[model samples]
Each structure stands twice: as C-alpha cells, then as structure tokens.
Target: MLRAATREAVALTGHLLRYPSGIQPEQITDPGAAPPPATEGEGTGAPPVLLLHGFSDNRSTFVALRRSLLDNGWPHVHCVNHSLLTWDVHEAAELLGEHVDRVRRTTGHDRVDLVGHSLGGLIGRCFVQRLGGDAFVRTLVTLGTPHAGTYAAAALPPHPLARQMVPGSDLLGELAGPTGGGCATRFVNIWSEHDLFVLPAHHARLEHPDLAVTNVRVRGVGHLMLPVDATIAAWIRDELGAQPTLFGAAAERAGERAGPGRPDAAGAA
Candidate 1:
C-alpha cells in the first residue's frame, strides 16, 4: 500500500509536465468523410485504441500502459487529453466525437476502443452513451471512474467540470437515464477498492440495465496506479484482445493471480 501511494505521489510531479497534452488539430472538424477499418499489415485488424487522462492530467498518464499495448500486438494507440478549462461535459463529449472521427479517418478503422481513467472515463462514457458514439466504440474500459457520480467532485464547485461530476448533477442524471439505442458498446468497468476520489467506492462500479457491463472489482491498486500497474496493464491487453462474447472469461482472468491474503476480486458474470 505504501509503495502504491508513493508512486501516486511521484506521478503527481509528472502531472505538471504533462498537463493539457494530446490536443487535436482544428482540421479534425473538417476532416472529410470516414473510411473503413484497415486490414492486416495496414496497422493490423484490431481497432485503434484511444486513452484518456483524468482531471487536470494529460496523456503522460498512459506512458507505461501505452508501451505495453504496443509491445504486445496493438498496432495503433492514441492518447487524447481534455482540458480542465472546458466549461461543460457536454461540450467535451462533442469535441471527443470530433477526435474519434479524426482518429477513425487516420487509421481507417470504422470503430475503435477507449480506455479512460477518472474524469476522462466519465467524459468518454458521455460521448459513447449520450453523443451516439456507441456505434463506433468497440469496447469502453474505465478505471476507477465514478460512473454514478462522485461526492469528491463536489469539493471543487468553481470548476464546471467538477460540478458536473457531483452526485445527482444534471449531467450525471442524463447519463444514467436511458439512451435512445440502449448500450451497444461492450463495457469493462474496473473499480479499485483503494480509490478514494470515487467516494463510497461502490460508485465506481457501473450497474446499468441496458449496458453489457463487466464490473471488475480490484483491490489494493490505487487510482493513480491504474494506468501504470504491470498486472492491470496485462489484464487490459488481454481483455482488449479477447472477443466481445468472451468478456466473462476475461473478467475471470483479471484475478488469475489470486493467492494467500490476496484472494480473487473478480466481478460477477
């Protein structure tokens, strides 16, 4: 536990250097029409993956995780950042839509995968659920994301982004409510027992009736370590490689290292 906390503190220092990274080009808005997914050799068959950082953070949060995916077999991986200055979640989602479209055009992939941490996860979910992004999102993975809203956010009322994350906020209500097409995207919601920003912990676990959500319950791993932990990175790599129908099997694999005091924390199928 001490080790994880120490790393989190170390990572905080890097945040200063990584703030507001991964800015998309303005030309993305007028990036012409979309193309089809690339086949083998042309960046491989797997869809390109996008990583989003937490509140006040940047793409550097994914330095380790991104390398792991690339070293394995994922050919195309991109890290996108949302600014803290953004006033509304809805606008962020809209901008995310543009970035997604631009990535699809660049990689020639019709659909892509998304992995988000903290506030980034919520924004990604808003794009997928509320902005009709499910059609192009193959799988959505969230680490320590407050899917049900977090009281921790209420502490920063001055930031509109923070206010939208408060429990029972209007934006939160809209996301929780029904979407017109239901949840077409495959969801892997990873919530750690060690996360404190999520307030009451359980809020990090998503329980949506319409979504095919695999609520992964992990222990000991802190919020900041989610993107850098070796084991978690391996699990996410495997999960992304697995077929959508085999999500249950992947969930079980997430806790394959269970032994002694560290019993399995796998989620229900």
Candidate 2:
C-alpha cells in the first residue's frame, strides 16, 4: 500500500506539471508595499505539519516528505490549495493561513509545521511574514525555495504571479532577506546545486535571527527532485525531531532511509 501511495503521488505530480497556471500580469494586484504583520505564536495545541507545492506543481510533490514525517512518528500532514488564478503573493499567504486554520479546527492542533517547495516556499514565508500564520506555525521548511529571484523566473512571461517570484518583486523582496526578515518562526532552506530553476545556487539562502535557517546544499539533485529525495526527507525529519517505529514487514524496506515507504507512517490497509 505504501508503495502504491508513493506511485500515486509521483503520478499526480506529473499531472500537475503538465498544466502550468497561466496568470496574466494585468490580473496581479500587489497587496502593497506594507506587508502584513508577522503572526504571533499561539498555544492552540501541538502543531501539525502542512505541505505546500511550487508553481506548475501540486501537493503530491510532498509525498516523500509526508511519508518521511509519518515514518518518524508525524501523522498529521495536510496541504494548501492556492487557486491557480491568484497572482498576488500576499493574497496567497492569506489563503494559506485559512487552510492552516482549517487543519487546526479539524485536527484540534494549535500550530503547524509548514513544508513548502519552490514557489510554494515563498508563499509560505509570506504567510508567516504578512499573514498571521506565524502565530500557528511552529516550523517552516523550504525545499529548493528561491529566497532571491531566479533566472528562470525572470525569463517567464510578465504575469503578475511570475513577477511576484522575481528576486526584487514586492513580495519576494519582503520575504527574501537575512533571516527573520521580520518572521517569527523557525525557517529551513534546502537547495540543490544542480537545480534547473534557481541557478547559481546562492539564491536559496536565508539568514535571520528569529529563524533557524539552514541552507543545505545537496549533490546529485535537481529542483523537482529535491523535495522527494530520501536524504532530504531524512534531513527534514531529523530537523523536526520526529522518530517513528519501523514495524511490520514493510518496515524492513522503509528503513532504507527517510526517502519513502514507512509502514508506521501509513495506515494499515
């Protein structure tokens, strides 16, 4: 079953990549120069982790991370659904906060650990910075998130959503900075030297006081491959401090590493 789930997730990601959202620049309305205040941490309950995907991607990009977390004893994993039409990064942050609240209400958890990949990471960072998600966010992990503007993003059509991703775009500039950037949650940035999207590699670093930012450079990985990499998953699991019992027959293979297929993390079929 775990194998099947993993396969399904990979397939889903492929489907998402086939249809990139076409956001027009005319439709993008910046939330303005003043970003929303950072969210305050609350004692709602133990925060569950939320997974977000990048542009031209879907929630399935987190399949490996989700499986690793579950294997390490984290069962509460959810995702964000940012509409394809929305080009405003600030608005995306707000919508993400609403989903975090929804997860809290459903699971009775107070805070959430946010895991985002690529553009999704930027969106999550904005949530903690502009929206009030920091109040309910315990940790923020980003895989291949371009803290600075990427060459590929600059080359994209001048869509509002595309412009927001540029290094100095109003939204990107707000979230991309020396750690803390006025955020109130733990932050982790994971990147690959061979990434096709964010080239030169240095664009993925985040340094701030309030944030525990770690710029991990991995070899033999690409932008799309980083999020699902087993080594990367294990690194995130260790950072989050979760450890699950690898039990049953499936556990044998699951122990191969934090990459995928852990029985304890998935339900028995």
Candidate 3:
C-alpha cells in the first residue's frame, strides 16, 4: 500500500510541475496558431484530434501524450483549456461542444476525435452522448474516466461537479439513461488498475449496450500517469490511426492483420 501511494504521489507531483497552470503553449501544438502543412505518410487527411484534460487540470496535462502523438504521425492535435472554476459538467460539455465546432471549422474536417482524461472524460461523454456532439466526433477516447461515477469523489467537498462525480450521483444517473444509442461515434475507455481516484477501477468502463465501446485495461500505471505513460500513449496513437473495431478482441485481430511487413490485400492494385 505504501509503495502504491508513493508512486501515485510522485506521478501527481510530476503532473503538477509539468503544467502548473494547465496551459503550456510551448508543449502542445495549437491548430489555430499557424496550421501545420500536411505531409505524406503523416496524419494528413486524418480526423483532427481534440484533447480534454481532467478536473482542475489544463491543456498542459496532455503535453507528453500530445508530443507522442505528433512524433508518431498524428499531425493535428489540439487541446482545450477548461476552467477549474466551472461547477457543472453539463456546462463544461457545452463549452466542449463550442470548441469541437471551432476545431472542425478551422481544420475543414467534417469530424474530430476526442481524448479526455478523468473529469474531462465525463465532460466529453456529456458532450457526445447528451449534447448531440456524436454527430461531429468520430471517436471518443477516455483515460481513467469514471463513466459509472466513483465512490472516491464522496470524500471531496460537495462542489456541484464533485457531487455529480460521486457514486449514484444524479448527474451520473441521468447520463446512464438511454444515451449513446444509434450514435455514430465510437468510444474507447481506458483505465489503469492502480487508479486511486476511480474507486473500483471498473467504474471507468462504459457499459451501454447500444453504444459501440472498447474498454482497455492498463496495469502498473496510476491514474495521474495515464496521460504521461509512454506505453499508454503508444496504444492511444495506434488506436487513433487504425479503424475502429467492434470490441477488444476484434481490435486485436485488426492490429495483427495490419501489422508491419504484412501485405494489404484490400489495397493491392
């Protein structure tokens, strides 16, 4: 127990030091700032990616993972800096809708992908499932998000959003309704076994029967480290680049079939 606590503490400290204000302009690539020229073999023509940080965190929270995506061929990566003072997840989701629209308009892409961490993930789901954002989103990837709400939040102050995150909260109950049905957007839920904030860890999984969901279990990483972990970043990059599959088993098969040095019968001339 002490070791796990020590690890989480170190990871949290690193996260705070890396993005004290949650908005580090130098580390992230802003699509609005001078758009990068599309390069062959790069993320050209791919869907634009919009990153959302966890609660009380800034766009800087995605610094490491964004760098990894860019380094791996993802060209258009953008981050949204939501205010910590915001009290409601629905309001945050509304702001996310605006940002998604802006990204689509500026990039000239019909759709974009969303990658959210922790509280940001919940906000993203609210946008996609509740705010009609599924129309504009191709994929929704979340890391350490509590889709089912978390008991751990019960210990926090009863802030509006905080209250919404506690297990059995009204917000979660409403969100758990018949949403995500017939939505075109795909969902990828990733969580760490050692995540301290997402009590029971399984709360991170999205269990909607109609929504196409992929639950990824990651071990040996803490909740705070999900965005910074190199392995998780690589997995996310690959997932973004590849076509979406039905579930984890199909995704694995798809990966094997598309592995390097393999001939593509579908693309053969």
Off by over 4 Å in 3: 1-6, 21-42, 243-269
Q: What lDDT does each candidate get?
A: 0.76, 0.64, 0.75
65-160 in candidate 2: lDDT tens per residue?
777777666656666656667778787788888777766665655667888988888888888876767788878988888888676887876778
lDDT tens digits by residue: candidate 3, 54-92: 776788778898888887767678888777679899999
Cα lDDT, model 1, residue 17: 62
Clashing pairs in 1: none
TM-score of 3: 0.82
- TM per candidate comes to 0.83, 0.70, 0.82
Worst 10 contiguous positions by lDDT, candidate 3: 260-269
Clashes, model 3: 1
Ranking by TM-score: 1, 3, 2
Tens-place lDDT per residue, model 1, 1-269, is 56556767776676556544444422333346655557632235778888888787778789889899888878888887777678888888898887888888887888889999998888888999988999989889999898888898878657988888888999889888887766779888878766778887888888777777777666767778788777778678766886442234664555322211145433211
TM-score of model 2 (CA atoms): 0.70
Q: How many backbone clashes does candidate 2 have?
A: 11
C-alpha positional error of residue 175 in candidate 2 after TM-score superposition, expressed in Å: 2.1
lDDT of 3 at 196: 89
Q: State model 3's lDDT.
A: 0.75
